[model samples]
Target chain A: MFDFPEFFSFPLGDWINITVDWLTLEWAPFFDVITIAIREPLVSLEHFLWWLPWWAVIVILAAVAWRFAGRRIALFTVCGMLFIGVMGLWDETMTTLAIIVTSVAVSVLVGIPLGILAAKSDRVEAVARPFLDGMQTMPSFVYLIPAVFFFGLGKVPAVVATFIYAVPPCIRLTNLGIRQVSSEVVEAGKAFGSTGLQLLFKIQLPLARPTIMAGVNQTIMMALAMVVIASMIGASGLGLEVLRGIQRLDVGQGFLAGISIVIVAILIDRVSQALGRTRETGLRRGG
Target chain B: MRKVLLALLVGIISISIVLSGCGEAEPEEKPLIKIAELNWGSARFQCEMAKIIIEEGYGYPVELVPGITIPMLQGLRTGDVDVYVEGWLQNQQEAVDTAMEAGDIVMLGFINNDNWQCGFVVPTYVIEGDTERGIEPMVPNLTSVFDLDQPECKELFANPENPSKGLILNGPPGWECEIVTLEQVTTYGLDDHYDVMNTGSSEGLFASLQGAYDKGEPWLGYLWGPTWIAGALDLTLLEEPAYDEEVWNEDHGCAWPSVDLFIAAHKDFPDKAPDVAEMFEKWKLDTPTLNEALAYMLAIEGEPVDVAIWFLKEREEIWTQFVPADVAEKVKAAIAEM
Candidate 1:
């Protein structure tokens, strides 16, 4: 008797019953287990990353780079970070900062170690490669649907969608970084009789830092893109103000909010790019 | 490598076994009933009214979720919303049918009929036929939608914004009016006489109407009742052909029939909250009353919540039957607080 489209007519009367239950019953608990054990502490570090005063953030970023990379790279980092705040987009820039920092933190916690394992074992890399491609290639909106289905709407789903969208780059980079860590370095470590875990920490990862940071810069850009899209699923931020303006035909308000987003994007883009450049220069100086 | 491969295989197998063992158990509490609130003047007010009665009056907490046209229907079919007030029959028939077929929603009775309508509207100037020359004079002979199809009349609306393209400001792109009006324009052969402009937001259309009226310029647009646009503008509906079922098919509901803005509850709603459902059953607001209430909210009070509460208070005698007298007293107290 039911004449509805079969797509909507599943035995689960409530779509959320099947979709949300499937997610919460299976995925949420698993994520909770992993996140509590590893991801939580890493997320806490993101707070420290944002807590630096506006000027100090720039100074500290440049200072760290100067000590590691060189003076030219440090100068670029300082100018980029300062430009973002001076554009009057400081608050929005920080919010975008907090989201990206938190997402990348969780992604790194999940991705880097997986990358290490994938690099070490051909079977692991084979299994991971397809999953990474799916994550990267899937439309960002699809990421939000499952997120809302699983977590309902709000900050949590926003972050979840953002994290899923941001993660692939870090994973791919981590794998490449570890694999590209000079066979000669591995040979040298083995010559010193370095154990597998010790050699990974002291040689492989340390040498791979610059490349991994480049991956992180890409992850931040992806996360920034997701922030605007997440407003559709009820994420509140500058993006919501922009959506609100569009809904009301407040052109001035929408334009201002759009400019705010652009300024934040440019700020983060420059700062992260500078950091990546500096990290490369640091490896050059050390080598 | 072999050992690691074996471990990973074992891990997958173990996870499957564990997952199979851990099947879903229905939650102990009844799910929070989600109510979809569409963004329109009367619909928002009506949803808020229902929320007031359900959550505050009856003491059953309901969550109000905001959604727009297609999304609201999708939400109901998905069971994201257990109740939705103001389901317009003319615009929402296909979605309603689809949801019914899926067993995703149960229809509640019409909240109030004889209120909703849509059509070409024209300023009183057009009806009076006040002509200096180029356009036809007011009051000489215009009475129907067809009369506006005159070339001279079309020339009067010649300005782009004037909708003189025989403009009817349609709802969103995919709305029922968008389809029906397009078909009607073709069927009636007024494509050259008029244009149907799809407004991005209802508010924007109302603002344009208000702007036109203030300037004393002749303005006509597509509109419906129990809407803020109706409350805000003084334009009159241009008469249409009768609502003969044969004339308007599934694809077209001829000339905007007066649809009943309805409140649909979950089938289980009466069982769970009999008192709240009773209030919804009795609650009714017709065109004149809704227009007044909308005017109060958007014009005089400038606060929708305040106007809604005021309406509830003014109509307390009518509502007291569904709610206990003491509870109604509490509702009055709540309104006073607002």
Candidate 2:
């Protein structure tokens, strides 16, 4: 009998690795392009040329909350900002906030319209639902891989990954909100000879405002969760602090950063909830 | 005249704002080289050293990306990461094999070639206890793997993941220990003597090792060298079957030889940022220096940056190897002035 030992004598591992290289050659450039586009801007913002001041941004945030939400939400926002400041993580928190805000803004611009379209057509919703489910359920780490593959790493890839994470909630919420519009309101608009655009602007979206806001709220929270994980791919901010803590086993820094994130999350949620309440009151007055 | 002046001022302000929004000339951009740094003791120190040079020494904004071994390799192959500094070639042969085959990564150079391997180890007390049935004093002709078949050695492996039999502590599943240990046991005909218990985190492995060391209990499992575990505890390796390259390769082989760590970079790094690549190539750390840095991070300072600074300060001579002679003197002068 021939000895089987000879079969395993070769550097099987090295040979196998060479084969994998042959396969990935085709798609590497696309990953490189995406990485370059996303990472460069974020890197500049993080390192050399941060545009916004922490206190100024906080003031603006509080002002927006007061205008849209109410006194309670505005107060909560101030407290949240103060907590992070007191913890000495104000800069880190602001950096994270900038990434989240930019990503959410971009995601909304892309997701809301797709959500509206999906709600309007049965076939579209059918096509979108599974994709949304996969997006939601797929492990967050896996999102980073495809992101890094497509974009590379840095601020842009980080944001793209964050967008992937934050988009699902907004899309689902937008679709849900639009679909939940009262049939009577839609009918009244149609009777008034409202066109599709007018109906969307006047009836469906207006009625869906609370649900859409809820979606936005969820998106914000999801984006916050992705912040630290994104740091694994070079998206710096509060998450980098948390990542450093874990890497160096610094419990104090990790927990403090984590607590700051919790405060920010609560602050955002309450402010959004208050805004939703204001919208509800406005709807009541209009009705 | 007042109204006209006011309108002109408003126009200028609006134009500036639009200009700032529209053509705020994009700041000079550079290709970001993503380097994945593992959380393991040596790996993290290597990362800190590389990051210090890349960020401060070379002034290239490097992102010391965080990840575990398997994912880091995945990142490498997929172009998610440009380089990984502390890839242990022998232990991570499988992952490296996959990555290399894909042509996603290139091996730059070795970082350090220190003595490191994995195998079963038992405390001194265990060897002394009931020498025939227990681990000690070569009782019952316990010279080879066949001696483990004795009934008294039943509790040899008892780790949680595989609690039913003799225990073997598993590090990360992808580690070479998994395959090598399995082969060692099989070749020595000790397959029925012990069971391999898989554990995911280094913390888990250490915690178990510490517990056994403290109690002086007979513990046998996979471990590597130049680590805090070896530094902290004293243990002896169990006998292994003789090494035959052919039989070994077929059987998954013995404890892996120590691998040289590397400081790698993307190809564009040299073209776009030659200075950065020059600094990287010149970067090297001996085993003792890395061990000392790790000890400081884990034992003394307990901060990555503090450890990095300490190493940089303490090893001024080592760093001079990388800098130009004049620049090296300047660096020393700067360090002294600071």
Interface RMSD of 1: 17.7
Runs in model 1 lying further than 4 Å from the true structure = A1-287, B1-33, B126-141, B159-168, B250-254
List the candidate 2 regions with Cα displacement exceeding 4 Å.
Answer: A1-287, B1-31, B94-103, B128-152, B155-164, B239-244, B326-338
lDDT of 1 by residue, B140-211 (tens): 466777777787667666533233364555544345665677787777677777766544345435544554
Top TM-score prediction, candidate number: 1
lDDT of 2 by residue, B181-240 (tens): 767777666676576544333544565465445433556667776566665555666666
